[model samples]
Target: MNIRQMIKENNRLQDAMTPDNLSYYQDMVVYIRSSAVQERQCEELLLEMARRLLDAQDKGKDAKDVFGNDLESYCKEQIERLPKRKGLSALQYHLMIPWIALTWFFFVQAIVGFVTMWAGGPVERMTQVRISTLILIAGGAYVLIHVLMKWMKSDAFKPEAAQRKISARNIGVYVAITVLILVAGVWLGRHLPVLVIAPWVSLFIFLIGLTGTKLLFSTK
Candidate 1:
């Protein structure tokens, strides 16, 4: 199964745990996931842990006994033991965000261009790649890399029960940021040194980005 599927399965398995075991296991979940572990590797490790603990629980072994009483140390040890992705594979993995960002960023522009034509808005705005567009692309890549690198580490330090989960407010914040980028990009494209790109050119670049993203993230 894929990493996301494995994560979903792990969540499902949590339903079968005895109350006490579930609490201990979930603490481990938050801790391990919050650590500086690669996402695919982390999910694999968690799924394995889930099955092993579930089996032990069936035989009446408590989580503390099956793992250990020293939760922090145990989690740290696991982090040390886990394999790190390095070299080209690691580089490709990191490239995932930018490729995706380029793909969607242009895709959205293309749609906006079409909508503008329909609504009789400024036709030239869609074709102009502003200084802000370059800033947006570079800034977006930096922000995404920063967030991915820090997210788990940030959460690892939180109280287990207080760990952040994906919620509507968090999603709304993201949407707001995206909308701000689009508005700022359009406004800035008008004021300075801009490339005279056609809407079809934007569509072509968008397609290339989409194809590249698919290849970049495709499973080996």
Candidate 2:
């Protein structure tokens, strides 16, 4: 019998074994022992009965391997039933490959923004050239490394690893949201007189957007 059927039979056997129903219990036990159920099934049913007795006596411990092995076996059966596909079957890895590529591109753009903002001051002509050159080199290296890695590696999206990396990206999104708020606050301060720091006003608005996104995307 399949596992599920075996479980059902076990449940029926258990219901018949209650101490308050001694006659019924004895009859059920006799029926089970005399039945044509396989020796293995009989042994499993007895083991389950012993486990329950132990639990009732507050001496039972968990059976780690049994459940886990059953699940693993079940999963293997399901996989065998699926249509065959080429290469690694991890979907998260494939998805993260593109994400990693996109993140690298955006990271380069952010660096460029920093370089421009730092170099554009009126007093530092030499600083502009130095900073801009460094930004360009850094951005170029980032793109080159990403391309090379993608070309060389086969499976880029391992979900377990990608989950951690995506958490870091979420943190970065928070930082970006903070910066935008600061900019808006500065703009507001320049235009309107306020009791609180003018920058904070814009910051509040920025925080709202960030908080909204976090709420919308949060899974749990």
Q: Best lDDT goes to which candidate?
A: 1
lDDT of each: 0.76, 0.42
Candidate 2, residue 161: how far the Cα is off, in Å: 21
lDDT of 2 by residue, 30-105 (tens): 4333334544555465446435543543433332222232323433343344443233335543433433443343
Every model: Cα RMSD to truth: 5.6, 20.4
Per-residue lDDT value at 80 in model 1: 92
- Cα lDDT tens digits, model 1, 82-118, are 8754324677766777667777777877888878888
Location of the lowest summed lDDT over 10 successive residues in candidate 1: 161-170
